[model samples]
Target: MIDDKLKEKVQMLICGDLEAGEKAQVELLINESSELQSYYKSSKLSWDNLDNLAGIEPSKSFVTDFWKKADKEKNKGFRFFDFFKFNWKLAGSFAVFFVASAFFINNYFSDVNSGFTFSEDVEILNQLDNAITLNSDSSLEVYGPW
Candidate 1:
């Protein structure tokens, strides 16, 4: 039933080049010959099946490794100290010392201005005694009559 000539024509008609007269001839031939019609039906089904299945290509197990790599990259955490790469401890220590020195110097100057030293008060008392002795009425009064 599937002779070589009709097979060729079936291949062409499947590819969409057959004219209306050619299709009508094929249809008339199919109705009059029962075995030809069955063979043609099966071949037409095969052609239609191939046409429906075209332009679809599936890759093999494509997502497993891709997802694993993505998860690994996602779980990698950020390092907080990465940007300050050099002399981090030195910078921190310098900042601490600078702040302490500023605080100490400010307090030292403030204390110096607010408190009186013992030596300064004793010198002032001695100057007052000398001035009083120079203005006394008698030699015995050089030292005040205590």
Candidate 2:
């Protein structure tokens, strides 16, 4: 575990903010401890290297170009119902299908021999008689004469 006091003094020493007495104490500790010596060397090297990297000013058009590209990307993102622009064509096709189906159904049902009829065919009447029976009182009341 690192000693917090020593660490603080080392950081102040690296940043050139330690007083003369504190700097002497920290130097003594650093010289005695191999870990403190290594830490001090690395921290000072990093600090000196950072000083060599001077800040560069961006070009005049950089901000405007950045905003234009950002605006284009924002516009391209998360559009709802974008594919629905062609839905009118789908609606037209569905209308045509329903009209054709209704036309066929109407013509089919309108034919003379199309739907159910009370037939005079004995075999069909016998089949119907076998399948149905006037068993319940409610059925009799509905089907029977008053």
Collision pairs in model 2: none
User: Model 2: per-residue lDDT, tens digit, 83-144?
Assistant: 44579887678779999999998876776465544464566888777667634545678766
Report the lDDT of model 1 for residue 99: 100
Residue-level lDDT of model 1, residues 1-146, one tens digit each, is 47899877766666677899997787787789888777777877876787776585666656887888889977876655553468789768877999999999998787688676667778989999988887665666768786
Evaluate model 2: give its lDDT: 0.81
RMSD of each: 23.9, 13.8
Give the top-scoring candidate (lDDT): 2
Which 10-residue window of candidate 1 scores lowest in summed lDDT?
76-85
Global local distance difference test of model 1: 0.77
The runs of at least 3 residues in candidate 2 whose Cα sits more than 4 Å from the true structure, single-residue gaps closed, are 51-54, 61-146
TM-score of each: 0.32, 0.36
Q: C-alpha displacement of 35 in model 2, angstroms?
A: 0.9
